[model samples]
Target: MGNEKDSLRAKLSPMSYHVTQENGTEPPFRNEYWDEERDGIYVDVISGKPLFSSLDKYDAGCGWPSFTKPIELEEIEELEDRSHLMVRTEVRSKKGEAHLGHVFNDGPKEAGGLRYCINSAALKFVSIEELEKEGYGQYKKLFS
Candidate 1:
């Protein structure tokens, strides 16, 4: 386990390692993918598991990448978080066990009224053009 973790730590950037492994949070509006506007999908940085779709992404004004939904509900695992003197639902990647961020009831009502506020450091964006090459061809139809 130590060797695997060490290898993973070496593979990820300091911010990514901190967010996904140590459950750290990145500064809002200063992190990557916060304002990304493209047709693609996001996968877990640690395990490369499918997570969120760009089509569901929106600017929640929280300075993070917010999505109306995940690419697959089964891909995410939500837990009750009681930290920082508050109660919240923390979202994590099922496969990687990476700390994604949090979810809230405040979102576009028409979109199920849920907001998945995710950390950019925990995700790796796979653009539409690279979906097939990246072994995620099934998701290319999302852009069409």
Candidate 2:
């Protein structure tokens, strides 16, 4: 595997580091902002590329985390995952290249029936309060 840990640390916070770097999962239902109803973007832990938005978020009760769609389709890289004797779509960050999680076809009808079951470790939420400060001011209209 490529050693992208150093680069990931520079872009993300310690908590994010623990998850992405150490492959740790944030406690279920106890994440810092898992229930955040704010309108904003969620980016990759390493490359800071936008992945998903609050608008596509839904409660899947799968434990880790889930999103309906990516903020930008090209920002994610999907690969055929056959790790556990099962065929699955493995989701990864296009830039950070970290393994985010899997994609499922069982989602709400309103969301095209696709669910991006992600790992909280692989994401960093950009709230409205920090969007402008984090160099993502251009996306402010997403909330407006």
Candidate 3:
């Protein structure tokens, strides 16, 4: 983990470092991807592991990017967070262990009744056009 942190420190921006490494949250509407409507996949910034897809994204009026579900359940790790005197589920990337964000129960029920309120700093977006070249060719079918 130390080596990974060292490498990530050199690659990530200050805001990314704070969000992903220090478990900090970016301001809701001011962050990236909150209103992104493009077709793509969101991956962990550090590990480049797929986390969410555009197909699962929706507007939750929370000022942050929200996904109904992840691309793969195994790609994320959910832990019980009791910070700020509140109980919440903290979502982290399984491989990178980056602090993605929290999950809430107040999502559209038809979509699964769960909202993965993720931080954009913890993720990198890969548009449909770049899926193949980015070694995510297998996921291209999802877009099709």
Measured against the true structure, the TM-scores of the candidates, in listed sequence, are 0.98, 0.80, 0.96
Choose 2 or 3, whichever is better by TM-score: 3
Top TM-score prediction, candidate number: 1
Clashes of each: 0, 0, 0
Compare candidates 2 and 3 on lDDT and give the better one: 3
Model 1 pairs whose backbones collide? none
- Candidate 2 regions off by >4 Å? 1-27, 30-33
The per-residue C-alpha lDDT of model 2 at residue 34 equals 59
Q: Find the number of clashing residue pairs for candidate 3.
A: 0
TM-score of 1: 0.98
Candidate 3: segments with Cα more than 4 A from true spot? 1-3
Per-residue lDDT value at 121 in model 1: 97
Ten contiguous residues minimizing lDDT sum, candidate 1? 135-144
Order the numbered candidates by lDDT, best leading: 1, 3, 2
Per-residue error (Å), model 1, residue 29 = 0.4
Candidate with maximal lDDT: 1
